[model samples]
Target chain A: MVHSIDQYVDVVGAPVVEQLRRLGERLKDIRVVHVNSTREGGGVAEILYWMVPLMNDLGLKASWEVIHGDEGFFGVTKSIHNGLQGYPVQLKKKDWDHYEEINLKNREHLLPVLEEADIVVIHDPQPAALLQMIPNRRGIWIWRAHIDVSRPHHQVWKSLKQYVQDYDASIFSLTSFAQILPHEQFIIAPSIDPLSEKNMPLNKRYVNEIAKAYNLDRSRPLIVQISRFDRFKDPLGVIEAYRITRKVIPIQLVLAGGGATDDPEGKEILDEVYKAAGDDPDIHVLLLPPDAHRQINALQRLADIVIQKSIREGFGLTVTEGLWKGKPVIGGDVGGIRLQVISHYTGYLVNSPEGAAHRIRYLLHHRAKMREMGKTAKEFARENFLLTRQIREYLTLYLYLLKDRGRSVFV
Target chain B: MDMDTVPFYIKDCTLLIKMSGFSPAFDIRDLRERIAQCSPSVIYHHYFENLLAPTFDYPDFRNDFAVWVKRQLDDDVLAERLGMIEPYRFDSLEDLRTHTLDIIDERLSELHFITAVPPGHEFYFQEAITVVFETGHVMNNPGEMFKIMPQLTSSSIYYHFLEARRRTPDLTDDFSLWLENFGSEWEPLIRDLRSIDFIFYSLPELKEELLYIMQQYEVKE
Candidate 1:
């Protein structure tokens, strides 16, 4: 499943693909390593799945590495993750010690590759301590924070900042999500691979088969909110919206997501969602496996109006996936969701369940407006939120960091 | 047809935006104060970079400050005044900053209270690093450009047509500046390109307009 840069010529133009080749030419044979916590089941993993191959395709020597952690280690990292996203969690000295101990163990095998690489990008907090481990490394290190840390818990950030403070640079998904660090903070928004199983177009027969398997009635309209069962995603709020909308409009709601290996709080959140959705035939609360990408794609394609009711989000790739499938999305008015969903253009941004219900009913009633918004949404994703664009920016960043940091325009 | 004319080398750019290291502005008075002290790159980013940024709607106002004024402050009169100050019309970013502050200052004097937004709605200052590279496509003549124009990406169109004004000594697009070397025959097409009200159109729409003007000139020739 290796992807060539030329494969994207049809989606984006040849000039766009040619631009990537030229940028890739400038940094040919530079060893770039990306390290993260999980190898699958999250946005970071999905990005690396295509990024490593694409970077290699463009003639750069690129590789991806993952750090393995047990349940206790993951539990601590999950607390750190939640704490970074403005959640209040008490993390003691033992928690930080365990986090450092795991990274220290992984550093034994990774130091050889990491020390000699031209650039090493540490994704998220799981492997952030690796920078402090490699004291004499001969490369530019960048910390890519994929979550909102605008208002992080003081204790967590105070501890975590020590590990990331010495990096050459850092990247955040949004400006608001960035914290006041001592290095240059670049803002590069995350994008989805349109040709992946999660976002690629599916045939009507396959979509219908998925619908039939899930016992979803195709006659009525469906509102689907696909995300992990986390408190920040607000799965219960989506159920509340469904109940509010179901009173007048006959609709089915699907709240489906897969559990990432590093997430220890997902099971607890899923149990709460199940209890909230009790005795409701139309409300399908599915706990999918990590590899259920095609099924998730089918579910999104089956939906009339897609919803991503997140109280907080990294970049809301589910909202992008829904938009790519040509459906109007109703996202929460927070984080990256505000960037994607325009009130009257693509879809509505709601702050409460009542607001979500109102928009759902309005879009369902006006079919023509829904069609117009869907058309606009697809083209919007094509222009801005595609993986090709993200790759181009990353290549450009490499060139900037390697060549010259003072110049605003690089020729 | 002229042998002495230089070829047009097509180039494209992609923007990498970064925070300007300024604290977020919570109100109009704070915005004016920051505008007075912030760097020119920060001013240029808020005014010109919106065209390249990802947005769902065709915004009524062109710049981020005006949009914030309209949406957050809910003052269309002030928004209208701020949006009307075109960045490209100024000789320098310093002049643009002065003009921008004047409008805000005028409005401030007439207001009874300071206009402010809620915590989450504050305006954050940002700037961009534009990476420019040659696309390796060259046109020997305007006819060749006419043939290759539609095949170019929107970024290419932006680089040649809009962003050129910032870098070129003549403060005109690359196409028109290059056309000037071909003598008086290409004068009409150069005038058409220069006369385009490019501030209102999106990149795609702007490309269409460029193509339309080229097609009209092609038929005449």
Candidate 2:
């Protein structure tokens, strides 16, 4: 267990850490397996990279499992993703066949490990079918959907919900995103690892070196947005916002992101972003690799303001990371960004490029107000978004699920 | 010129505005008579059929009608401004029709002409006008309809049969299948009326089955 949960004492204080320890004691030695589609990139993988180790440190037997699929399988899953995020995509019979074929293959390799588990938490639509595939399953299965399914495409949702609605419980990032299912639904927002390399505090020399490597000038005001290059992230809208703000304030915008192995649409979106960026030197679009953690950390640290202008988001971990790093975030007023960006308190919630530009100019002009907002943002993250708080809730949920076998448990 | 001399342009063509629930007893006839005397080439209803048919139920009806008016009378910005008022927000369809007539009255007094085609001339105007009802809450726009109405129950029976299918696959015959097919087939027809054109309780010919479904599902207005 690399992350001992004790290391968070300095950031979140010893009392919260002790409380998490006390909650963890009730579920000691329980075999919990987290099944997801990828081990690298995306918020889910980055979260479990540290989360699994931390769970083991708390005296629980936690393991991470990855599902393997080819490009065809990934293509179908991407359609399901966009559909769940409210983009209408007509998924045909062949797409369903491809999705099931991949899951059926994965079920063969995963059955042995899954059969012996005390609890299995399936993340997102990619691995949702595994619960039905694993014959004579002994453990409680929880379907954790980490996307905004508030207004899903009716056809795509009909296909996906048939597999997940019968799970022991379903988890969503926000209550607004929860679907009407027969089983219990829990609204547990995604959290950030403050002690990880991507969010940990760094000194001046290393931060400056990473900034200079990316050709960023520290003297000028910088706006950074870190997310996967997905259409839902609205990277082009961020560029438009920068253009509107640049007319008055001389600022540089950095749209830095990496691709997840299981996401097939990243390259296409990256190409679109490049075409939209044109010859604007001030608009830096960096397509980094999956392991560029330190680089992302430095960019966020050196940034004057952080923007996560997503059109549809499922608890943006980038917003949490920026808040933890003491930078006010200007996020689109959608999805789970609404839960964090408190309008004028932490930052602003904007609807369009014009709204984002107005807020960007307002913050850059008022240095003292910006600093105060940043300070408030860090405290907000510390109170609500730390990993310890997330784990404590999970522990509580595990205990509750263990005690109640019925579909009545909810949070 | 004599003070009582009629302009030569008055003999160009006739302008007729047609609306239901309108009578000579109402004060609107004064405006109607003034419009008739103008000998305007355009008739209001027929001229705006293409515009009204696509926008009567659309939430952007006001803005779209304004654009159409602005294009037709490029120099009359006041007429364009009058076209943009959200008449649906009035107390009733009568109120909206009266407000429209008042605007036309103002335009006739200023421009000495009207900008509309005579009624009954449009090819599909009667069919388009037949679908619009004067009562019940207006959906007005597709965007607003989706926003206000519960999406789950809007077209699918899945939410209705949720409990029956809880334990196992609820294929209970071909009911859901039939409903899905029906929803897909009926989407285009209802979308035009509910989105671009008006839909009301008075559209009994097309709305009888819909009203039954709403009652069975307990869809309160």
Index of the highest-TM-score prediction: 1
lDDT of 1 by residue, A210-315 (tens): 9999999999999999998999999999999999999999999999999999999999999999999998999999999999999999999999999998888888
* CAPRI-style class, candidate 2: incorrect
Worst 10 residues of 2 chain A by lDDT: A402-411
Give residue B119's lDDT in candidate 2 (0 to 100): 20
Residue A317, model 2: lDDT of: 88
* TM-score for each model: 0.98, 0.64
Question: Could you report the DockQ of all the candidates, in the order they appear?
Answer: 0.71, 0.01
Q: Which is the leading candidate under DockQ?
A: 1
Candidate 1 residues lying further than 4 Å off, grouped into runs, are B1-5
Task: List, residue by residue over A1-411, the lDDT tens digit for candidate 2.
Answer: 246888888887664565566556667899999999999999999878988999998989999999999999999999999999889898999999889889999998899989999999999999998888887889899999899887899999999989998898887776567777887666567888887889887899999898888788778899999999988888999999999988888899899999999888999999999999999888899999999998899999988999999998998889988888888899998888877887677888898988889999999998898898888788767756877667865775776777643222322
Q: Comparing only chain A of model 2 with the true chain A, what is the TM-score?
A: 0.97
lDDT of each: 0.90, 0.67
Q: When superposed on Cα atoms, how far off is each prediction in RMSD?
A: 1.3, 22.8
Instruction: Kindly report which residue stretches of model 2 are placed more than 4 angstroms away from their true locations once superposed.
Output: A405-411, B1-221
B94-203: candidate 2 lDDT, tens digit per residue? 45455656776666567755444222111111111111111122333323333323321211121122111222343221123222333354354343333322222111
Clashing pairs in 2: B42-B116, B43-B116, B43-B117, B44-B116, B47-B117
In model 2, the Cα lDDT at residue A346 comes to: 82
